[model samples]
Target: MDDPVSAQRASSVRRSLASIVLGFELIVVFLATLVIFGLSDLPAWVTLGGGALLCLIMVGTLGLLRYNWAYGVGWAVQVVMVATGFLNPAMFFVGALFAGMWTYCMITGSRIDRQNK
Candidate 1:
C-alpha cells in the first residue's frame, strides 16, 4: 500500500523544484524581452507585445504545473525560448542554459520522488 504521507512529500518536492525553475525562467524571459526591444530593429510592438505575451504564458504555466500536462507546456516554452535565437543569437545560449536547468530539475526531482516512494 502507498503511504499517503510519502506520496504527498514526493509531490511537494517535485512541485517545488518545478516551481523554482519556472520562477527563474519568468525573470530571464522578461529580461530577454528587454534585450530584444533594445537591440533588435524589429517593430517595438512586436518585441514588447510578444515578450509580454510570453511572460504571461510563463506565469500561467507556473500555476498550472500541478497538472502533468503542464510539463508539456513547459517543454514547449523551452523550445520557444531557444527559438528566440533567430531574433537574437545570444538568446540561443541563454535559452539552452535554462533548458539544461529545467531538464536537470525535472530529472532530479523525479528521481527524488521515486526514492521517496
Candidate 2:
C-alpha cells in the first residue's frame, strides 16, 4: 500500500491511524480505570467512563496480533458493562456496537492478507 491516490501516503496513513488509535485507547483505558477506582464517588460517571474506555480499546484490538490482548480486555469489560447496562438502557450503545463490528471486520480482512501472502 503506497498511497490512497499515490499508494505510499495511503499505507502510511493507515498504519499511522492504527498506531495512534490503539495508543490513545490504551491510555484512555488506563486513565478511566484509575479514575473510576480512585474517585469511587461518581459511580454513574465512572462506570460510563470505564465503558467508553473499553470501547476504545476494543476498537484498537481488531485483527492485529499485537493488539489481541487489548481486544480481549476491551471486549471482556465491554461485555460485562453492556450486559449490566440493560437494566438502565439510557446510554447509546453505538460505541460498543462499532467496536464489535470492527473486530468482525478486521477478522474478515485477515483472509485477504492470508490469500495475498
Q: Pick the candidate with the highest lDDT.
A: 1
For model 2, what is the alpha-carbon lDDT of residue 98?
Answer: 35
lDDT of 2 at 42: 53
Clashes (candidate 2) = 5
lDDT of 2 by residue, 7-52 (tens): 5323433334444545554554555455555545557765667557
lDDT of 1 by residue, 1-117 (tens): 999865684466677888898899899989989999999999999999999999998899888877878889888999999999999999899889989988998898888878876
Where does model 1 exceed 4 Å of error? Answer: 1-11
Which residue pairs clash within candidate 1?
Answer: none
Candidate 2: worst-modelled 10 consecutive residues by lDDT: 86-95
Please give the lDDT score for candidate 2: 0.48
Instruction: Pick out the ten consecutive residues of candidate 1 with the lowest summed lDDT.
Output: 5-14
TM-score of each: 0.89, 0.38
